[model samples]
Target chain A: MKIGMMSFAHMHAYSYADSLMKLGNIELVGVFDDDLERGKKVAEKYLTKHFSDQENFLRTEMDAVIICSENTRHKEMVLNAAEAKKHILCEKPIATTIEDAEEMIEACKVNGVILQIAFPVRFSSPIAQLKNLIDNGELGDIVAFRTTNRGQNPGGWFIDKNLSGGGAVLDHTVHMVDIMRWYLGKEITHVDAMVASYFHDIDIDDAGILTLEFENGVIATHDASWSRFAEYPTWGDVTIEVIGTKQTIKVDAYKEHIRMFTSGAKSLSNVFYGNDMDFGLIQDFVECVQKGKEPSITGFDGLKALEVALAAYESSEKNKSINL
Target chain B: MRKIVYKKLEKIDFATTTAKVTIVKSADQLTEGIETFLVDEVNFDSVINDTDKVYIPSTLLNVVNENLYVYYELEQYPFFKKIKEVIVNPKGVLRFRRTGIITENQRLIASDLVVFSAILGEPLTIQVKRTTPAVTPYHTIVTVNFGNGTMAHLEYTFSNDDEKIELEWSGIKQIIEFNSAEMNPFSLKNYTSLPLAYSVDSILATARKADQNVLNRLEEFTSLLSGGVTK
Candidate 1:
């Protein structure tokens, strides 16, 4: 499969490039970003060529396009890619609004193009195993779930409300929300959330906490914050604690068994790094494309996740429970 | 001179990989006996048997072999309980052997109390200490200034042949700046006061049933914040 990247502004854009370049079945044809210089730099860095405009780039004899431009720009990119009869691997939250997300889906369907949301957590090995366990009744009924998706502040367009939609909640909550929907096999019926700007002085939220109740009466909590201190060795941890009727499962993707001691005046911070999630997710996407099947997480899955996030935001805005 | 002893914990990098460090501390100069411990980035729990025999936690026993001794002043103004000793797990990724232990000084710190990520990676040296360090909500940056000294060349080179790596050591360094400062961690209670989607009603109801006062939870939670909050 020949893959071309539409933009490099998204955080996972580089990871996608790295994945496509390394995967045996997929060959990267070219790459582009909104900025020519940035696109050229990324292309050169990844050992790929650059395209001057979207029109020319879409016209390339590529099997697919990975739309990683920006949250707001996703709709147009997907529409254009679909018009070119190119399959899409779009990064998540799909779009800033449901209208745009729906349009992206419509365009894909109209053009009979495959559209996959870039929700990498769905492809996580542990998560997949956990889902299987739940499906197989190994854990019985799930009682509660607690997860933390944290990181250091992005400090870029991520802090801009208009560009990124919202702060940590919109930026970080979608991943967990999407994963929760996948795990619970139910829709998010209600959300009550609180957002704040405790860490960064940015107008957008630097921290957010959402408490959710799925339609199946499963209770879940998600802490999506940019709270890691700069001095910490790594960015942050993504931990999911699932409490079932029979057993409790804790999935920590960041913990390593290795330890270090320091007798010097300095102190120690952070335990591990490199969850390798991006690489893992991208590899799965490439494989799915090669197998001629829909991605495990489709564009609709992305939209559903966005619905939960939107409900959370609406709940926060209204200071009340938002019923889906 | 006053000295503080801390155990090595886990080492974390930018990619969320952790390396555990286990250590044994003995005060040969003052106290007799040994102190065994398991340290990670978060918790330090251990057992002290006699003055000479310290039973280090077995979970981290594989990572460390030899014991280390850290010495601090026994006679301070008045904070001296016993000889101050602690096993530090730098990253909160591992657990100690036991739940709690009493130091010689009689200070009963919680087994899970952790000094947040203070230092990691290669060690840097500082010459001067500034009393009022610049602070960000997430970190404290200390600046070291060494105006003019001919002999103080600011940098040196050292590497043990056994370590198989060369290390450049800079003597006098400054923090220049730090942004993260201490803040109270945020918990589930803080969100109760904020408006939310109705889908969370059940969760909020459960929180309420757990004896949390919904109306005052926000004030109490936010008031507890000196600055930092965690999930």
Candidate 2:
């Protein structure tokens, strides 16, 4: 499949771009970035042409486009991509607001193109196996979920609440929320959260703990934050503990690593030897486009996850549970 | 360390995850040679051969469903007890979060509120959320906000033995994690609370049928269940 990448704003764009090169069947058609310099440099590094204009970029011969724009700019890019009759693989927190998310989904549907949201956690092998177990009733009736996706603050436009929608809570909560929804096949009924800018001297929130209820009557909690320091062994962690009628299972997605001690700077670190979840995600997207099948993770899935995350902010500010 | 003295008594029975320790009441309990025990608890004494093991009352063990050493028995639990060895001063805590999946017989929420109240002042507001499976409440989450902008959240669920737990304290610059999976632990330090378990009359009376903390939480859960004003 020929895939063009829109906007290299998100850091994940680099990883996805690398995955694009790794897949033998994929052709990295071109890259379009509003920032001409960064776009040209990325295009040159990947040995592809750089499109300076969105019109010309969309006009390129590409089956799909991966929208890795800023969180606030996702809707505009998705609408443009859909108008151009190109399938889209959009970065998460599909849009900043529910209206934007709904509009994005509607446009893609009207255009009759696949709109897949990027949720790489679902691609982790252990997570996949856990899903299988749940589906097979190996764990019995699903009861509760305890998850965490805490990472170090990725400084930049992320600190700007307008650009990133919010902060750690918005940035981190969507992934696990997507996974939970997929596992239970239910919608979040209510959201209550405690959010604050506790770590860094920033205006946006840096820490948040969310308590959520699902349509299936399962209660869950997620601790999403930019609370890790520089000395932390790895960038962050994505861990989940699922409780069921018969058993409970805990998983640390990034736990398969070797703890290394070096002599010089950056002394202690964990060298991960686990699956590249991004590659798995892109591979799945590529398969969907090649097979002309519906996206495994639809835009509505993205919308539902975003709704919970947005409600979390409202829940914290209002100090009450926000019902969907 | 005060020497723990005990009288020969009926029976002392307790256990960890692996082995079960039973001290039979009579002098004939031990027929073999001197058996040494790395003692941490006491209930009664025995005329068993050698070791100078002190008598500990049964009140010491944090029992759940007749199986001890499951939940946050901070006094002897290696991991949580680490909190005493580490953080000598409990100040400037930004937030606190604790999550546990355990078995509970009562609709009590945050049974261990004393841990939070000890550090962060009295909770300004306690918010309770419970999950009812059929009739019995299977889950409860209590979120407490202190007047000083400090917030603590505790989640508890019933019929789950996944007791590997952790207590977290978010300080200004660092996060303190006191979890069940503690690494190379040091000797437990002396806590200020006198051991009520070792008291003479502790065994005679109903040994902590329910502490004040658990009772208060029970009241809160009760009120919440009845649609009380939730803040």
RMSD (Å) of each candidate, 1 decimal: 18.9, 8.0
DockQ score of each predicted structure, in the order shown: 0.02, 0.20
Cα lDDT, all candidates: 0.53, 0.71
Candidate 2 colliding pairs: B42-B56, B42-B57, B43-B56, B43-B57
Q: Candidate 2 chain B — worst ten consecutive residues by lDDT sum?
A: B189-198
Residue A275 lDDT in model 2?
Answer: 96
Q: Across residues A1-324, which tens digit of lDDT does each residue of candidate 1 receive?
A: 788999888878988787776676677889967688999999899778899689989888988889887688888899999999998889877988988999999999899888988877765667767878888887667655666677778877777767777777777888888777777788888676655565556788765666666777666667677766565445666667665655656675665434545555435555554345677777766667677787777889989888877777787677666788
Across all candidates, the chain A TM-score values are: 0.93, 0.98
- Tens digits of lDDT, candidate 2, B69-175: 11223333334445646754443223333343433323323335544555566776666666766522255566666665565657665553423345776555566
Best by lDDT: 2
Model 2, position B117, has a per-residue lDDT of 57
**Model 1 reaches what TM-score against the true structure?**
0.59
**Top model number, TM-score:** 2
